[model samples]
Target chain A: MTGTEADHARHNARMLRIQQARAKMQARRTLERGLLIVHTGNGKGKSSSAFGMAIRSIGWGMKVGIVQYVKGSWETGEKNFFHAYPDLLTFEVMGEGFTWDTQDRARDIAAARAAWERSKELILDPDYDFIILDELNIVLRDDTLPIGEIVDFLKDRPLSKHICITGRNAKPALTELADLITEFGEVKHPFKAGFKAQKGVEY
Target chain B: MTGTEADHARHNARMLRIQQARAKMQARRTLERGLLIVHTGNGKGKSSSAFGMAIRSIGWGMKVGIVQYVKGSWETGEKNFFHAYPDLLTFEVMGEGFTWDTQDRARDIAAARAAWERSKELILDPDYDFIILDELNIVLRDDTLPIGEIVDFLKDRPLSKHICITGRNAKPALTELADLITEFGEVKHPFKAGFKAQKGVEY
Candidate 1:
């Protein structure tokens, strides 16, 4: 071949390879199944983070199951509002109020255990896409439930189930077992500075 | 109790009520936590959303961590290009190649799960304010690991932890548990008919 023709041939080959590479990359995609997430720390908004993920997942036409672990009875704007979503499934662990308000550890543990049971179904079922275990870490940390059993159960859950757990005092074992973990640190909190949490914002 | 003062008192009470109600509606604020979020979707700009959140969070002097999940093998122009923010924790998943190119599920899963494990430490550490689990859905759906367990773990995490899980097929359970959910439907995609994903824009 002529010098110019050979040069053109090499350039064309390189271009072809680049195009192929791009096509392959574009075609690569992963399917939707399950996840395990932990949101913990001193900063605020752990529930919000879990809830945010829940809402996004539902928007994709995925079935969602939520178990609010601790703050159950008191009216929450999110509970009132998010329950309206047809795709979202929700359960509150407590019956009337917080532990301090009710002053009953037995009641709290019973409620949390009940909620955890319900969550187990969702976690083990491949049919459900996402599961939110809100305030579960608090329960675990407070000795309301056995952490080892919980971790073991979670470790063996269905491959298709995606779970999100939110609360404070995330245990080291839990963190070690988690595929994804998040810790929130408080730098400047409105509440610590005497700013009461607003209704829709903080609640 | 006076008649003249009573009228003014009623008006003042009404104003207070209005202000309180408005404040309640806007009370919700994003959480601060050492959490990681992965934004991956076929639609577009998953990373852009993450970057936007990162910039906003960093502006508040909150430590931020980011690991670009996928698209690392090739030398993209956007590497180490965060406007000279040395404090931002950044890394690339470094696919070594695209998922299809590797064509090895075990290898892909290993790489993804490994990256996820590394991210787990950062997410659990309180030193960082925000951790972005970008494109994590892809890994979950790929059957790299058990997504259900992952979700369950997250739901019961620390109280202060804040997490963001972004990607298409966000899963129903995730949506149900999230505080805020946004779905970007494809009203019009440039690639639908026949257009290539633009550099810097799509990547």
Candidate 2:
């Protein structure tokens, strides 16, 4: 082969190598995956969103665990609905209604602590696909649980395990550490419009 | 009046009223507010399960809107992220990504048109609190828009609308109706391994 032809071939090989490298980089960019999420803010559907996710996960034939803090009474539709799918998911509500309704700080703390213990299993368990800590922010905000301890537990969880912490007023520390953070801000509310909370709608 | 006697009389009156209401015999179920939802099951964040409803709606301070049509796709890290907000209430994802991916066409069709055009206003107008069309089954499978008339107009709208749809088979009907419908299914997913999608973690 001529020297010029050989040089051309070398250049072509180098171009191919660069193209291959670019393709690999693109593939890597698209291959990203994992889980760490926080749903925070003064919106209404935080628990509902988490529940929907839990249900979807259950449908996928994945084991799901839920720890609902500060919402134990008043017969939630979700609790009833999920209960029907016993084989697919496991859920626990660790609350005694609203804090004002319960009016027992020590009892509330104990309930939250117990729920947290169960939540730890779901957060750390490799067998479980999702762990929902419902209304945990309320627990933290009310000083029912130690925020630092909760953060530490979450930070130390298995890399593959997914955790969902739902509630209003998510601490800045949690937000900063979260892989994904969402803040729900209120725009219009039925309560503000004189509409009473309706069953099968709000609760 | 004696305290005991007064209490007894009040209780008796309440009981009589209850009996009379029972005899009249009509269960009064609270009606769900009529809402128009647009769920296009064809996008990456589709089953992040409509963060628009779970987070943005809350930011808007509106009532909850939820419509889930599929199963799975719950583990994408958005579920936990959005559910943290309080104002953004209610989210429902059909959970299924695509019929071809799940190999269940019947389920997909059933889920797609479950409540067609019910979410039209939310898709078309900017007044809704939160409108989520979780995984719209029809659009993705047929590639036909879910609603011919509504979608075309939405494309050119300027309303501050909060809408989200998820699924792998976004049809023309959906594209027409959607202010935003994301399509997310596996181009080459990493879960084919012994790695089954985890519950709560993935969903």
Candidate 3:
């Protein structure tokens, strides 16, 4: 079976049009600035995406600083694997645990404040090229730290540094400042099918 | 200004409900089979997600085999950084380049077939725990290889092997067999603003 002559002609025409659109779009894009990116949604890869970006940064010999909020001191595959890049990646896991695990509003707030303190220093420091605020949105959602305050701090951040904020339920105000936003929508998760979140894979 | 008591109560109630739903979901999931995962859509970071998983798998001391279907031999940061894991990670850049660059259908088909041959060997060999097929969807889009060949190959694969296929417009047959599928919806891309794709980040 084969496409008719008309069908083939139409396909070529469609391809040509798409090429033109892409070229037009590409020509207009020339700015190169550090991006404020947000990864949010109910999907499993939000924080994973952030870590992935961190790896990419490290691969390029860029210095990376990471502050983990809400994950606490648990052992994670990313933290362990990225240990290989000590000079390029500085990782700090500061949260006590998830909000549910802590169950204390005051403690959670304090931990967030401490993590944000670290985050502020990382953002301000000139040595780091990329900073990842892992799970900051979760803390923001719990109101442990005011979104406005964080946004205000980011306003004057260095122009060469890229920042990635990952978690679910990001506030609208944060979204406004993000140059790139990706919502990882879940199609099917094996956990719902009774697949335990195994070490290395889920972490 | 502090929230009223009603606001606090509403927040706690919402938190409680979320906790309950999470607990219920956690309880229902008990299966532990290896997954066929697909990362597809117009968004960025699909390949980065796969690389992140590769890092996780490496942390667990698992062997990884990677095949780049359409990304020809440009010096990639991943290739350089992951080179440190020579014993555990095997990275191959097999493509002749993007189809537009090659502009030869037969040449594209041959390059894709060679890559798939490598992919088949990787997936079938017991040495590899995880195999990543980067940009396979693009080759599939151009009919470089038939979808049925891939689906049939995956059918009899090891029960404990995890395979990740990344690219836009994944074939429906592959999606059908995939245990987890994520559509990375692009909210913002720097290229639209005229920023070119950078080495580490875009690769």
Candidate 4:
């Protein structure tokens, strides 16, 4: 065979070896169950990634429950769009405001307790397939809620229920219970570059 | 004042100081313009987060365009969902398959070129409010497309158009030109724990 033909033969042999190895690796991945996903760190896309997962779940006719623990009850673009799917999605925005806005630790703890009560119900409900605890980490970080209690409950959740938690400073207890964790780091931000948060993009 | 009253008074004064500082900071953020956003690294949600941004943009009655450069022409949950909004979104999946599946360098380069041409058209179109170039970073990393040429074109894009690119191992030149960059790191993945990818959640 010519040099080009020899090179083609070697490439084909290498590819076959890779394909076989991948198939063997895939065969070992047969376990299927609900996952505890955590998205945390000081960057964008933590909540947005959860929102995207919500869209994917709804696309497959799955029921999704979202309980926003820290976001104020503002008119967000996501909330407006998600409202169109009333039958599939139940979105409950129950926050008095940020910690500074409320300036009352007692009130903040009360709000977190109320939100957790709602989240607990959704997590236990059989109708819901996915539950998004948006920014629940902030509540844990501020010590508004007991981390041990929350972690214990999450650990004992139903086997077929998928739960996603999004926010910065995820507690070590929570991360240890998670099946998947993605830490988003900021390399650059427009806000630090003198740009105000724009509608639809930053919301 | 009583002891409790004095404590409340101090809290109120501290809250007032924080509110004033935030107000002063918010005053300096007056600039507004489009953003060149990049999502990269070795974790999930790079594409999913971009899809979430598409939803946010569409929620505000903005037109969106998407070009999937590396994902094969399979039925994805996001693709099916976005198809419902034909008038508002233009979804294009241009890749034949991943490089391993295709196994042809010339063919891969051709596919990347085709996808880039479509992306260029969307970026230049004034009617589009947001554009997503999904997995274009993989194309740049593989040398399927020249990084310098892509960077130069993006540098000259309209100041009022928002563009988002998502994939792993994003080129340094691209990130340097980006207004916002997020690096997603994997702490733990379910796949490593012997869990197969689930429908609606991993798609």
- How well is each residue in B1-203 modelled by candidate 1, as lDDT tens digits? 77845754655566466656655654653333333233323434344445545544544555667654565454432343342456654544534344555555456667777777777776777776666676666666655557786778677765454566666666555555554444433323434434344322233
Model 1, global lDDT: 0.58
Instruction: Count clashes in each candidate, considering only residues at least 3 apart in sequence or on different chains.
Output: 69, 71, 7, 0
lDDT accuracy of residue B174 in candidate 4: 96
Instruction: Give one digit per residue, the lDDT tens place, for model 1 in A1-203.
Output: 88855755665566467668777756653333344667676555566656555544544556677777777444555565455665445545443244444445556567777777877877776667778888889888877778998999988888565677777798887877665555554433444333444333355
Q: Provide TM-scores for the models.
A: 0.45, 0.53, 0.90, 0.94
Per-residue lDDT tens digits of candidate 3, residues B1-203?
36755665565566677778778887877877668888888887788878888888887788999999977446777777788888999998898876655545566678899999999999888998889999998888767899989899898888778888989999898888888888888887777666766644665
What lDDT score goes with residue B175 in model 4?
94
For model 2, the local distance difference test gives 0.55
In TM-score terms, candidate 4 sits at 0.94
Among these predictions, the greatest lDDT belongs to 4
User: What's the CA RMSD for each of the models?
Assistant: 19.1, 14.5, 3.6, 2.4
Question: Which regions of candidate 2 fall more than 4 Å away from where they truly are?
Answer: A1-26, A30-34, B1-203
lDDT of 4 by residue, B1-203 (tens): 88866876677678678878887887899888889999999988888888888888888888999999987546777877888889889999997687666666567778999999999999999999999999999999978899999999999999887899999999999999999999999889998998888866788
lDDT string for model 4 (A19-87, tens) is 677768879999988899999999899988888888888878889999999875367878878998999
CAPRI-style quality class for the chain A–B interface of candidate 2: incorrect
| C-alpha positional error of residue B51 in candidate 3 after TM-score superposition, expressed in Å | 1.0
Of 2 and 3, which scores higher on TM-score?
Answer: 3
